[model samples]
Target: MQNRPDLAVGRVRHQLKFRLAQVKRVQPLTPHLVRVTLSGDDLHDFESASFDDHIKVFFPQPGADKPAMPSAGPNGPVFADDQPRPIARDFTPRRYNREAGELDIEFALHEAGPAATWAAQAQVGQYLGIGGPRGSFTIPTGFDWHLLIGDETALPAIARRLEELPPGTRVATLIEVEDPSARIDFATQTDLYAEWRYRSESDFPGGALLLALREMYLPTGEGYVWAAGEATIMRAVRQHLCTERGVDKTRIRAASYWKRGVEAVHESIDD
Candidate 1:
């Protein structure tokens, strides 16, 4: 493990730095999960304190050798008219070490797009640009228990939260993935009950994640729930937690990472 940044000293930082990172190593964690480690000199001042903090990754065009990065101005990023806009995708910061100037970003190899394509062919020494988280949703530690539910896209965030949690903290995690081989070991000391649900290729279009949540016995007491993944499926899970399980709306944080068959989409609970 590397030294963490002083990011969480107080509240979340609205002002952040954007840096160009070079790919140091890429390891295939599972059949559908790849862990990419990036390091750069400019990343020394980076800050990401929240569990679900996002970093925008810029990808080069199909035939281009490098991505055109947007310059930062007083307000925000400044783009040039002559240069082609780089394709960008939002991803969670799985791990970061200020001492080493390295950040681990996990990619779920479930979709096909510029980001996916880039991850599939990512090589050492390749550069990828990253930007601010803008803000973070830091969960309070006072909850009796924690419930983390999502698909592969939410795994990085889930793992971050699990590792950050204090020892003896109780947690129940529901993860829907391609198969059992897609499972990842939790390195945290928290009392975690992890459930990995597999989806059959022949199965009809349905919400397997929601079904798994409905069948499980939710832990008792005041708990905080974080759910992310397919939009409609997440909607159903949020509804179930509130209407059926009597979970408080304010205690649950839900976000739609993407929609089935929809291109480049994300919707948060507040959206």
Candidate 2:
């Protein structure tokens, strides 16, 4: 298992040294999905913590020049003195290849956020600045079972988790999406029970996922529950997991991938 590195403690220090990366390739994976591969000389030092850890992307406007990516601390990368920096957005690192000095990020082109718009039109050789591996969180695979819940924005992280899991591991996944055709397959050799919750065009977040979760049957055992989606929806899931299902606080992870009526946000849970 690649010796798992001295990850627990040294991970934070490694993250603090956020190096600036440059965009290298961009392609559409699906009609609503864009895959962007970034690379830079600084990537030689990029250390990955886990699948779900995220980085910030600084995107340039159509007419404007590229923006300077923010540094981890007060003194980091300096922007060009002449051009004003473009808007930046937070996104998850879908894949990282330090040997090849490349990192891949997938974006869902649903909304017109700065990040989404940039990704939809991204091209090879175009330069965008990147910073941070931030931090990582993972539930111990030794658990009796695991539950994964999320929407499209959370798919990359969820997919990463499924891929990294061990064989014979038991997991339950409930993914909510606008269409059933958006479903992506997972090949976890584990005892996995996955369900897809489709939210029709007439429906919105927190509607179908909540009802499906409420009506679904959960196996009885000690399990870790991880969920990410719209802020309010995830909060509801968290509340149910803690109060209704009687799961321990530490065993459950709920994050808001995006909020309704908001734009260009990446942080899970605002308040």
Candidate 3:
């Protein structure tokens, strides 16, 4: 439990650094979602104030037991020339308790890759490395309502917003899951009206989430929207919001967590 697993702990600066942590516990949220709790003294200063903030999870190489920690370079991350680059993937921070030193990250057991493979078999005392989330996009809370849309991969971020948003904020959620069994409940104080669309019941061309968005009614007044999941569908959703619904581009945030039919970033690294 080194203060800084990959670099010396800073005495003054608070820049994000690589942290070495071990799995303390795991919880199966659903048949296809697992929550892995990573903890260590190195997380005492972990900062993830924004609901949609992400962290880079580093996994052990092919046959290694633990991930190789990267050192902070003058301008970027630096690794040894001979060392195999550990598999890394972006994951949202579901929860972070600095006082108790704990970080919870959820994995969508959808794709087969080093990150998902590691999370699926993660057990107590298993080492993992995390870094960055160097910045946060703290959305303004003045919106009259909020619209959230996504799939299993977006759950971590969706859940975070629900838990942290103002209790009185009105939120409309449209989530598409693998099946009915994948639907989940949340503990939050936001004024939420949620709708679930099962992929098993969806017709292609637009998929469940986009179709749901098409049929549902968005709340009135100035509103904010956040959507994530398959890249293609996300693009369509964003387009619809901008062109069809007239939602201001600045007030909507859409991201592609992964692309359908393509190997995840970890499995198909580009040269």
Best by TM-score: 1
- Work out the TM-score per prediction: 0.91, 0.85, 0.90
Candidate 1: regions farther than 4 A off: 1-11, 201-206
Mind giving the per-residue lDDT tens digits that candidate 2 earns over 160-271?
7887788888888988887876777775688889889878833666688888888877777667778887878898888877788777676677787788888655554322
Clashes per model (N, Cα, C within 3 A): 0, 0, 0
Give the distance in Å from residue 7's predicted Cα in candidate 3 to where it truly belongs: 37
Q: What does candidate 3 score on TM?
A: 0.90
Best by lDDT: 1
Give candidate 2's TM-score.
Answer: 0.85
Q: Which residue pairs clash within candidate 2?
A: none
Q: How many backbone clashes does candidate 3 have?
A: 0
lDDT of 3 at 190: 88
Q: Any idea what lDDT model 1 has?
A: 0.82
Any residue pairs clashing in model 1, and if so which? none
> Model 3, stretches more than 4 Å misplaced?
1-14, 264-271
> lDDT of each model, Cα atoms only?
0.82, 0.73, 0.80
Q: Which residue ranges in model 2 land beyond 4 Å of their true spot?
A: 1-13, 18-20, 74-85, 266-271
Which 10-residue window of candidate 2 scores lowest in summed lDDT?
Answer: 1-10
